[model samples]
Target: MLHRFDSFLASRRRFLQVSAGFGVSLMLPALEGRAAERRGAERATSLITLWMNGGPSQLETWDPHPGTVIGGPTRAIDTSVPGLQIAADLPRMAERMKHLSVIRSLTSKEGDHERGTYFVKTGYRPDPTVTHPAIGAVVPYQLGTDHLEIPAYVSLGGGEWPGRGGYLGDQHDAFRIFEPGNSIQNLRARVSDKRQERRLSGLDVVSQTFRAQRQVQAERSLHGQTIDKALRMMSSEQLEAFEVDQESEATLQRYGDSSFGRGCLVARRLIETGVRSVEVTLSGFDSHANNFETQTARCEQLDPAFASLLDDLRERDLYDSTIILCLGEFGRTPRINGLEGRDHWPGGFSCVVGGGGLKSGQVIGATDPEGEQTSPVDPVPVQNLYATILQQLNIDPAEELITPIGRPLAICEGSLIPKLLVDAG
Candidate 1:
């Protein structure tokens, strides 16, 4: 059965609507615990996920099998690293390949969009028995929020499934922003300061009465907690982190004039402001038809933003302290269908992960050159990827968290891919 907190999150949209008078409706988590105590000098403090909403074709993106029958029209281009070639569409990312590690054999059992998304983001297949927390939620929960007034977990350009707090509670749910660089709504009260003060006072009185009627469950109520966080965020200086327009025209142009680009820029600012995890979503990758054209368009928007993010992180000296993950739920099938498109394939795919003290310029696995086999050469399970990420963040993968009903679950069940780590061989 779903927990009470789960029910609360289910009705969050209605709750926010009812509480709009508070001038803050973003469900910010009530962060508990002290700042993260680093276990290693090279551990990453934050994560930036460039989430490709739909499945992107590995043949057209990371694992280009140029000149092959299933390679389609996509060509491969050489990168800064010798023998490392990405899709020709992503020339910018290719140039910055020295800072990335391409995993060409990411495999999963979930092929449906929703299921795959949950699995990739949470490192677990869908379990009707329990809702699992996303890696974003797990990061801040393990590392603590570091007293960040802004939500430690933020999602830009909300997708079908933004990261959820799951058993971690609604407080860890991602604060959603539909548009990057846009001003947050209802941040300031419409009425005068005196009026707002009087309103809050009245609210407290009503809350006290409500609590009195349900004394047993009053302490568990998130109403008051949500209000307190809303007010704090309203006055936080960190709010400026969302203003991607504050960047110079040159910087803006470098990142491109797309929402995804702006979101990437905002993600950098949030990371700089100490937010633990930020995800920038770019949709339209579900190319079940006209695969080549669709992929090219998506890459046009992704290339600049992704490359610029790397440039800025390195420039600000934040690269070593930040983990970057660029991938989708799964990958497109190697076999081109009748519509000149590719279908979903969970067997063998590609994802790029680097930074956060990870070894760079390395390719972990490979798919068949002929693209005939459904499976890749050395499959990296989704859980293992999660394990590697948790280890890099100084979070123990073996650590267990208790569900609301007292069921214990480990943070991650997979083992670390030692080659990905800088210190590991």
Candidate 2:
């Protein structure tokens, strides 16, 4: 039922066909010139997704029902973003909250872990059949960045979304750099650049052999975009931006010494230089046995580092240009179990938003007390959140990308929450 992208989305599918036919030996300019010519735009328009891998407890973190018995041992504290109060452990984030907007009511139909995750990451419900690409992939597909030397999507920390360019083809897929320490693993330039070239040439010979015999289509099989992406990463200098150790000791300490903190720092640094979208996954939310206690520790680990990231962004004058998002697959149950934990609650949850010039210091929607899934005092869905984010980042939510067979799919399903927009801010 998406009304947009009825035209060119079909041709866009050929993007991957280009790489598939020729194989990965050669590279083409990404779709930047076209994206820049779009109708409306935003000056502040990059995105950083702070992914909480496991299903974080909703009762304990974002939609805390204090009066309810499930509220757990923690209490709420006021944030600098007045009218917003988060878990007491978020003292650091509390101070820089004026810049944040909280969405307390977000729901998805998928109940299982994988399904819920796909919903949040792709804006579309999972159909075990058609895999949806993560938002990082969508970022470059839409905006294409000004002049990115590396692939547009960058995932730091531990977790990463597995899907890529659903209908957009292999070339439009995300190039994930798994190593947290070094964005590129061992990409040193050897004695002669010719060595790597020769290797590529060898790859080309194999690909050409296949093309001569001819498959149904002229797509690269042995050396596809995925392989080429690795080759580019091996020789890329753009990865230097991921070095947190390069930052001053004081700066690193400010973000805290934990892995998640470092990941946050890395994401900011990646975007600061030129990466279009950097995702830092803070995994470890599946606290079924000791949910509350474990969440307290996780939030504590996240609070200061996350706060420092926001502060760092502001101090460096990067806040407006970049958007920060914190989310998980689903929220935990409202009732704590006998094991002293909460179960998955895909019915409703909360999300944190900042910068990208969003209308901040306001709650977009609400969940009822008792942490039960109910119509929000103001109702909204995950797609709205995705749509709002896209609009804020200057992406056209209405744009469409086609599936391989050529079924046009809207990039983002819902309309942007108008209240979250800045002119309305």
CA lDDT of every candidate: 0.86, 0.69
Cα lDDT over the full model 2: 0.69
Tens-digit lDDT string for candidate 1 (1-425) = 22223455566666567656667655343334322222224333899999998999999999998898999888999999999889999999999999999999999999999899999999988889899999999998899765577888999995788888888877787888899988887787777788888888898898899888987666665777778888888887778888876789999999989999999999988888778899999999999999999999999999999999999988887888899999999999989999999999999999999989899998989999887777788889989998999999899998999999999999999989988987887
TM-score of each: 0.94, 0.84
lDDT of 2 by residue, 91-143 (tens): 88777777888887788887677767777888888665565666777887787
Error of 2 at 165 (Å): 2.1
Model 1 ranges off by over 4 Å: 1-11, 27-44, 216-221
Clashing pairs in 2: 20-219, 20-220, 21-218, 21-219, 58-332, 81-97, 81-98
Worst 10 residues of 1 by lDDT: 31-40
